[model samples]
Target: MKFKIPDRRRLLIAASLLLSSAAHADDAARAQAAVTDLGTQLRSALMARVKAEGPVAAINFCHDQAPTIAADVAQKHGLRIGRTGLRTRSPGNAPADWQRVVLADFETQAQAGSAPQTLRYSSSEGLPEGIALRYMQGIATEAPCLACHGQTLAEPVALAIKAHYPEDAATGFREGQLRGAFWVEVSSGN
Candidate 1:
């Protein structure tokens, strides 16, 4: 049978679909790149703090810096930014919106005996129309980190941690265990 010519309406619909998909892909890529850049800066700042002060200081610095850096990057890119720490127990069965990408990377790095430096992507479960990106780095199990994040918190560090976070659960870490995960979330409106 002879093939019929395509109509204008059908051609337009196909073109629209192609463009929408391409736009989504582009948005995801751009969001990833923005987060990567911000993460690099945050890492550099945290490392500097660690070198200047100590691991506890670095953790404190990161705690303050992560959100600021993420917000700045998101604002610059005209996107929303958010982050969450991975839990010891997978929240897969929990009602809360758990971030699995960061947790997986942290677990992989913990098993490999290396600091995690990978950034992964995922989409929101509640808002499936958006894209999410995350990055995890090993918090060096140094003496300072052990103070608060260590199995036995040092007096001074413990006091400081208590003062800052009275109900903190980010502790009881070993010298080489994954202390916690750092994350960045971006919505692509896809």
Candidate 2:
């Protein structure tokens, strides 16, 4: 009877762990989806803003509205979402300590001819002694990004960017380069 009881308890524990793992995976997937949707929203908005207000205005839109949009999305999804870059146009775009490490790794991989669009990473990190899901997707520089971030910027656009971001370092990018990444972090309700 005693042996049977222990066996049953062990089975219950194993089942609980399996269920927990599944739930963690679901949460991670939700976080990734939220980040993708948020990135689309921000990119689309910036594109429209640039079309209506021009590349100059697009820079301003990024400086002014991008954070707000990210914050809103994060709040809605119950996750932390944002972008970070190797050479940040806005100092605000500077990656956190962990993100800096990832960005450098990404830069190295990209230099080795990895498809920037296909570059991504996800991991579960111990947080508060529990596990949390973290994800990052590379932002490849495309033709549309050149107006402000290209190898050569228009004189006026450069001036506007300088006026706005006195410490701007996010430029001199070529098409297909790694501009940065959109990241999402969500706590597993463990």
Candidate that scores best on TM-score: 2
**Candidate 1 residue-wise lDDT at 87:** 37
Looking at model 1, residue 168 earns an lDDT score of 69
Task: State the lDDT at 157 in candidate 2.
Answer: 97
Report how far off residue 25 is in candidate 2 (Å): 1.7
lDDT of 1 at 48: 82
Report the poorest 10 consecutive residues by lDDT, candidate 1. Answer: 87-96
lDDT of each: 0.57, 0.84
Runs in model 1 with CA error above 4 Å? 1-6, 88-119, 124-153, 172-190
Q: Give candidate 2 misplaced runs (Cα > 4 Å).
A: 1-6, 9-13, 128-131
Put down candidate 2 lDDT per residue, 8-113, tens digits, no spaces: 8999999989986887678778777887888799879989998898988887778889889999998889888898898987787789887888889899999999
